[model samples]
Target: MPAVKVRKEEAERAKRLLKRLGLYDGRRRPKREGEWVLLPAVGGDAIGTLGYEVLPLELPLRPERQLYKNLESILAERLSEDELKHLRRYDVIGDVAVIQIPPELEHRVDDIVWGLRRVHPFLRVIARKGFHEGKFRIRDYSIIWGEERLNTVHRENGVEIAVDLSKAFFNPRMKGERYRLAQLVKDGERVLIPFAGVLPYALVIARYRRVKITAVELNRDAYELGLENVRRNERKLRGEIEFIHGDAFKVLPELPGHDRVISPTPRGVDALALTLPKAERWLHYYDFVHEDEIAAFRRRITEECRRLGRECEVRVKKVSDFKPHVFKVCADVKLG
Candidate 1:
């Protein structure tokens, strides 16, 4: 297909107008040559509407480059050396870029937003204002640039997940964790996810393994999104995924036994102890703890199983960092 070639400086404005007219093709990246950007257009009509010259060139589809490389260069003149050093990396969830602005560089957030948008023309950048809180475990975010909406469809491991940042919890950082859990699941095995936010873990596992999964969520909004996500990914799924919208503690006990269980809730390990089915199963439990406290965390899971008269072997591994001292750890426990 032909694309509209416009000056690099005017590409953002042209993209906005093209998107508004429903002529933007997201599947192809804009081809750049010298000072001009070649945007994928539905037809030559977009050239007149966007006021750009037509380029009858076929650009090879390529994966997007990292956003930070361009952002760092763009903000070089606007940010001080000390402030630039404090910039943390951001996450791209579909077309939304969720960033955390450090206190030192907070005043230059507008410049940062502009830099992000300039680098990734299609992305809507937002600044994360608060930490993940409450039972729903969702963070507060404010629009820094681009669109005002919080809802977006994020694709991960060949599955599509529809989530609203204001209503539910969806972590793009957990892509590796979801993939790791899916790889561990065996064929024909039954799996359970007690903290299945928007069915990311369940959907990823279903796409890769032929297993039956029962996902439970406490938050009503997240539960509703999970159902929608499951329906959206139905054509690509390889197994059955059932969603239960209620507290894991209450909903888990009534459910049947499963070969594997995943508890990724941020509410702590108490929920795991309360809802674990009284049968032999593999438990993938997540928690936040310091490196030195990993042993104690493992002992806590062991004690929980001991109290229930179920012999178990527990191992803990660092999944990611929660802060400078704290870490997001996973305790893999096998109960018999």
Candidate 2:
């Protein structure tokens, strides 16, 4: 086997270049020496041109099961390359694995289920999901395999959140976003969260910062689950959470201003006018917008700040892709 010897710091960059040039060997694992890394690669003219010393080193082959990281790879033998293009990314929530099977892959449900099970041996349920519907934003789901339940205690960012997909809305994809918000929060700051679903943002923030967070949710089921999540993570939390069960429109008016406000606004609901005024210092507002309308969206927020007589700096960050040319954005508004 041929391996390229490069410094440890340059190993990753070199490996990427090798992979991009179609010279990197995937079956073998890289070896680390004292100050150098031996990257596994196949023989090619470009390998020598990569400016690394090539030597005959016997690299260990990767374990058969550790070769592929995604479900598509495991199902490559079963699904055609054309059919595989329609496969969507799946999410694993606690013991349940949720996937969306397109119309093209309908006939291969059993194979898909088998692939999921093969990839995740500990999954208790496999569910086929539909679009979010109604006011609660709960997705339509049907159990396709294993246990028949959507209720699970999902653990993220050092907090345990009890979620019922049938009742309350919970998006595991927002785990990174929740962690990002948690990192931005400071201790002793008074934080407010409206449209707080299952207290995911609240619980994650409270887990890290020693601050007081008032979270309001309109969904009774989500509020109840949020209460349970607070209790479940009570001992682990470093901060305090006051969960309110009511419409934010009615509840926020009765409450005082806070140091910071986070509005994980529901899709199609514009709460900027409702939540922005309640923030004394900063507001993290989330919404969906078209790619071309991003500048317009920022201008709208800036105008809203001006109308409220607050000097603010608004920066819009694209959080995730909602659809083609559409993105889920977060406007981090800093009030002066």
Candidate 3:
């Protein structure tokens, strides 16, 4: 049928089934351009569907030569089993597979890597590791990495955030974020970043908004590195970002409420899924939606916020296609 008709049907179906159905990774996109499908449950507990151009592309589970098949499988199974939900897609080009995942799945980070190792020595579950390293890196933040590593080449406000896998955890494309954050915050806001993986989000916010950030991280090593990065680049970026060396879940209770809170841990969303240290304010959008389906996605979140009596807005900060159909979003959630 036509794309317009299919979208109308998909929208209607999604509206009625919100309780049973959830959005796909917003990744796994372009299933079959302009076609909407109501799919069966992948494992159990989660109902996935594609609409007006998105469909699932399932490839043969090729473990050999599939670089991260073990890791992907382990993560896919674990996330689906634990949350009974997660967005996953595997691209099988010959014997190799590249699986793109949301940032919210970073906590079980170690398990992801270990699982990959268990699968086969050749299959590598990768991590961007660190954005920066060396004399600038504090003792606790120093990471031990193999001679060779993967890196995410990102640029923000002119300073390129190139990952040095031997050291950092994330190297994000912050263009969308820099703008999205600007839309949500104001001057003098007390922004809190719990589990501040790399401090990019917090710093980005302060630089854009004349705000104060109290960044917290439980990982001693990560905390120190975050602290150093903030200081090292302080001159470059405007505003102050204080790194708190402790768990945000525990830390939040002791501290007073703030003007705003930022949870930069890539694997952040759905408060219930996170058991460690949570900073409460996440479990909302971190993806910046621009045009296209922005209105639809934003409307969904807005409606949910209203149902719970919470006041919020949809701020689209970035828009980039991760893969062919998978897109990454980083939007800010505010409570008034």
User: lDDT for every model?
Assistant: 0.81, 0.90, 0.48
Could you give candidate 1's per-residue lDDT for residues 157-248 as a string of tens digits? Answer: 99999989989998887888899999988999889888888889999999999899888888899999999988898889999998988887
The 10-residue segment with the lowest total lDDT in model 1: 58-67
Please report how far candidate 1 places residue 214 from its true position, in Å: 0.6
The per-candidate count of clashes, in order, stands at 0, 0, 28
**Cα RMSD for candidates in order:** 15.2, 6.4, 12.9
lDDT of 2 by residue, 1-336 (tens): 689999999998998889768788976899999999999999757777867899987688764324233577889989999998888878888898888999999999999999999888989999999999987899999999988799998988888989999999999878889999999999999999999989999999999999999999989999999999999999999999999999998999899999999999999998999999999989999999998999999999999999999999998877887999899999999999
Model 3 C-alpha lDDT per residue in residues 1-336, reported as the tens digit of each score: 111113534654653444234332322222323455432223322332333332344423323324344445666656656531443433221112233444665565455545544554543223322223342231122222232333333346544343433344553444455557656677766666666666767766766777777877766655665766676567766567878887666776677656665555343243312311222343334543334776676677666666667676655443555445445665455544
Quality of model 3 by C-alpha lDDT: 0.48
- lDDT order of candidates, best first? 2, 1, 3
TM-score winner between candidates 1 and 2: 2
CA error at residue 231 for candidate 3, angstroms: 1.9
Rank ordering of all candidates by TM-score, starting from the highest? 2, 1, 3
Best by lDDT: 2
